[model samples]
Target: MSDRPATSRVLVIVPAWNEEESIGDTVTEIRACVPWADLLVVDDGSSDGTRGAAENAGATVCQLPFNLGVGGAMRTGYRYALRHGYDVAVQIDADGQHDPRSLLSLLEPLGESDIVIGARFASKDDPYKVRGPRRWAMVLLATVLSRMAGTRLTDVTSGYRVCNRRAITVFAAHYPAEYLGDTVESLVIANRAGCTVTQVPVTMRPRAGGRASHSPVRAAIYLFRAFVALSLALVRKWPAQFEDPVAP
Candidate 1:
């Protein structure tokens, strides 16, 4: 594993939709924590003033034409990072569950891997927990993905992730835009395209603002959705394997 410097040109991309409540503070915290990195908030056609809030908090906001979900927003971010000549790209939720302070540690493994996942449950000490079917779905996904990538990945659903230039190139062109596509399917795409993956344990916190999107009560439905996501990811045909066309 090559050791990457803490000073690599970094772009922190935050995909947001109607996150005006938390966008400002999230931007502020990222700037305060990773001051050396550039911040971009891809506002996914929010009906609120998310763009203005992010700009006021000192982040460059990229407004989408319509709501394309987190997957589409991040695809834009990948393209932006590739075009602007950034060495690293990191994606964190705009809701603030992903702590900005963990970002540096998340990027540490990039020298040796194409992707570094800021996993929420890699360590036994991590207190973050999902109960019932949600937990089962996540565990099932992790077990299968770990085997596929030849590495133990505990939290495949977590959105906090860091990617190097090579992974960015692959994602810029072929990142999925479907539901659950950003985290689960994206990893499969990266692995299939010959990218290496690793993880660092991190604890998740309560959202700084906005509402939580998860509800464990819908057990059966959630489990079925998870299965469908994984099945679709496995059966989909990738036209041509990504081979880092851009010089790194």
Candidate 2:
């Protein structure tokens, strides 16, 4: 377990969209793994009973009236963390692909950097293979983002990440607000805002239940959108000021 400050307030933010099949179990597992952390599930207008399931599993549900996509739902979580004065916030996927047991590993790096990504590709013991076009796309994104952030990034699209107070504040205000926006664009936003970002090796499990949101066609669309978003992020000027820097 991380030897973080005892006063640090940590929150586990789970963004769900039609993940009723797995959200409950995901919440339960997180509670078991990190019982001290508060849990919040942002239901992005899921058509099923995702909200109720998450609540029943002992998570505070933040229901959106309409579909806002993952990026918007994540922004909502960041806003909540900032408003509640949380010292750290971790983003966990509702699909169960992100292992709750790795939550502590993700938090371990927050002492040295503002953001720590739980990178799947960083793990040597458990090789999670991404075959076909999706694999190629991931490689391209990782290469581009690594150059932009001035650091090696193996899993650019990984959702398992921990962020400190400064990151929460910046994300709450300027998070990307579009489809497939959060991953690449948000990294650029954090780097441009002068927040240090790093990654730790983590093994991921296959989704516990329900269909994957990304089909082959969707993967292609995401790649195109990601490219556009990254390009735009490159041209955007840095904001005049950011949130107060937090001590490592």
Candidate 3:
């Protein structure tokens, strides 16, 4: 690798749980789309062969000893990215939803923004009747939080995203663990820390394999918990002190 600026290095993190059906293909497809990116699959206590499949597909694998949920696995990935000195870190789900080709579009905003969320509303593939309610709820909550926190955001629960070194440093240090809306904890924390955040539309597909962990009941519980947690977090001022793991 050339001794280039940190901004040029990108690492893609996929936090997977029992996704043996899609992990290998996801890694292969991502490598095909962004060959320069270093792919890391954080296997969140998968009993299946997800780790083997990802490794055979040529991605660097980090298998967590226990199931840490999405937020925990993602934070682990951020730590890996920071330790490895990656200039950028991107999160893509292992369930075949996040389009690998759209990674570049997500990463593009890093030139101006510290973090970029791949908004699904921009895609024509979204069925409004189904996604509309979820979108509305997220937008409503995000707007309230943004106004309260003195920040702006488009998609608060988006899983597809890219973050530059500035973001990796911040997240690796103080990322909230639970009750954070599907990845909304990071968005809120980033905003609180004054990190530039932007949203880009990305086409996401239904998982080709395995059932989603979130059912209607689970989603409701998650939403209620997230709202309460964010309300508390929004009121506090996050100090801007974070350690850069890769600093010499």
Q: Each prediction's Cα lDDT score?
A: 0.89, 0.85, 0.78
Please give, for residues 1-248, the per-residue lDDT of candidate 1 as tens digits: 22335668999999999999999999998888878889999999999999999999999999998999999999999999998999999998999899888876888788899999999878888888788888899999999999999999899999999999999999998899987899899998888888999999998999888876566557768788899999999998775567554556
Worst lDDT 10-window in candidate 1: 239-248
After superposition on all C-alphas, the RMSD of every candidate to the true structure, in Å, is 2.9, 3.1, 3.4
Scored against the true structure, residue 211 in model 1 reaches a CA lDDT of 76
lDDT tens readout by residue for model 3, 160-220? 8889989999888766667563376677678767788777877778896888664676656
Question: Model 2, 158-248: lDDT tens per residue?
Answer: 9899999889988988888765458887888888888888898888888988976668887777667767776786788868467633223
Better model by TM-score: candidate 1 vs candidate 2: 1
The backbone clash count of each candidate, in order, is: 0, 0, 0
Error of 1 at 81 (Å): 0.4
User: Which one is best on lDDT?
Assistant: 1
Model 3: lDDT to the true structure: 0.78
